[model samples]
Target: MGTEVQCTLCPTECELENHQVGGCKVRINRDGTLYSLVYGKPCAVQVDPIEKKPFYHVLPGAKAFSIATVGCVLGCKFCQNWQISQALPEESEHRDLDPDEVVRGALYYGCQTVTYTYTEPTVFYEYMYDTALLVRKFGLLNSVHTCGYINQEPLRELAPLLNAADVDLKAFTEDFYGRICGGRLKPVLEAIVTLREMGVWLEITNLVIPTLNDDPKEIRDMCRWLVENAGPDTPIHFSRFFPYYKLKNLPPTPIETLNMAQQTAREAGLRYAYIGNIRQSGENTYCPSCGKLLIERIGYFVKQNLLQEGACPYCKSSIAGVWDQT
Candidate 1:
């Protein structure tokens, strides 16, 4: 038997023998050594608005050079990017962009941050790590939109490099996580708390899938937990879910449901709760102190920003976000 090694990058902790691949499909064990198959081979690359990453609070209106490799830690049924997230390295089309090239691309495109997004960045750890070092060295920021399914050591090591993270807190229940996302919920919650503790700017996204995880009580519970653990200043985006992938049978989340979720978050003491995936007033940022409009946005486009040095321009309340790159 060949030597077996355990991949501890995520909570799944896949132990693989020689020539065996991990659950993420991006890491392979070869002759007693583990190798990341997707390093420096991102399948998706784009210059997107920072708000497209749904990072309303982080350098609003700035562009992000986003990149992602093929593979993910979890298999969410409703994943919008399932085409790349669920593909094997050999099955996907990718670019030969190395870490230094990635940083250069961000600079070339005049992006304020380099984002690891579209798929799980955790699976592309080595690539993200190396690129993040260069991104920081070049005076640019690093951000990620992730599922928050990473282990503690790696997360801590990567936290310092990350300027902001938009975590998909898919649902509040372990059953929902297991049934809908093929993962557990505890580690994600732990990761959220750990990120906050490590001083990384954190945000949360919950895609409201009509019957699956849109319970009002559950939303309240999730918001309360965020207030208690991640703090009330943490912005939570309740996104409307449209039928896609394995979840096509379900109807799109009712507008009322998203509204209820936003109300629930505020009632649970969360200060900055926003609705996503639809055009509404919820997309704008308002001062949690004096209820003054801080930033006006329209579909990822910032029309006007009223924040002065990360604070409300009118009331001067310190808004919680990476509003300035410096």
Candidate 2:
């Protein structure tokens, strides 16, 4: 009893004995106290375009100072960043960047947004929470790219400091999540709803893997649910999946499948559905009412943004996004 603690950050509810790490391999129990081992330690750090986070609606083309530590809550067989996400935090190379240093790095790199990405930010919750607070002092916005496999309390606590988020929907069925992701679907869905309730700008990313979760009907159901629960304007990115990690036996997701998902989303009342991983017209943001081009993107780079003060120039339709940081 003196040397055991439970991690309530996520649905996993990992209970650990003294010196034992949780499922995330980041949070550890030490003498009846929980400690985050990856706090102030980042394995990856860089300046990336905000679009790379697939947050098309938030600060388009703005540079984001991105950082991530190793370890993830889910065991996605096809995780692109499994090299880090699957490893123990100390097993990877990391930098000694504290909250203040993280803020300074973003400012030094001319990035107005700080993104906790490349791996699940929830695993490193303490670090991200502290960094978000420090970054706010200097007028920098904070964003998270996550799996959304977190409990409501921690997510609610973190929401006030967050400006935007991109949650990976992964798939629509509990079976797919259990078999392919080693997780549950319901918690992720709840996380999405909670983020929206907190008034956080939310976007979704669904990687359409061939024959796995690429069924058009399921995609439509997911879209319809978003439209009903999260709203029609929630931007959804249908990302193309490439073979990686344990799922390399499967071929990459076909272009046609991504197109089908995108079409399904629009038809299901989603106003801003996009295709990713392949370059084409789906990358651009068009006005839902006027069908006029609002933000033209060419493979993660903004070609032209025609929005005049966050409204469509032709019809003056209000675009839903965080256009201004101030």
The 10-residue segment of model 1 with minimum total lDDT is 308-317
Error of 2 at 194 (Å): 0.8
How high a TM-score does candidate 2 get? 0.99
lDDT of 2 at 313: 97
Note the Cα lDDT for every prediction shown. Answer: 0.94, 0.94
lDDT of 2: 0.94
What lDDT tens digits, residue by residue, belong to model 2 across residues 1-326? 68888999999999899999999889999899999999999999999999999889998889999999999999999999999999987778999999999999898989989999999999999999999999888999999999999999999999999999999999999999999999999999999999999999999999999989998899999999999989998999999899999999999988888888999999999999999989999999999999999999999899999998899999999999999888
RMSD of each: 0.8, 0.8
lDDT of 1 by residue, 15-58 (tens): 99989999999999999999999989999999999999889999
Worst 10 residues of 2 by lDDT: 86-95
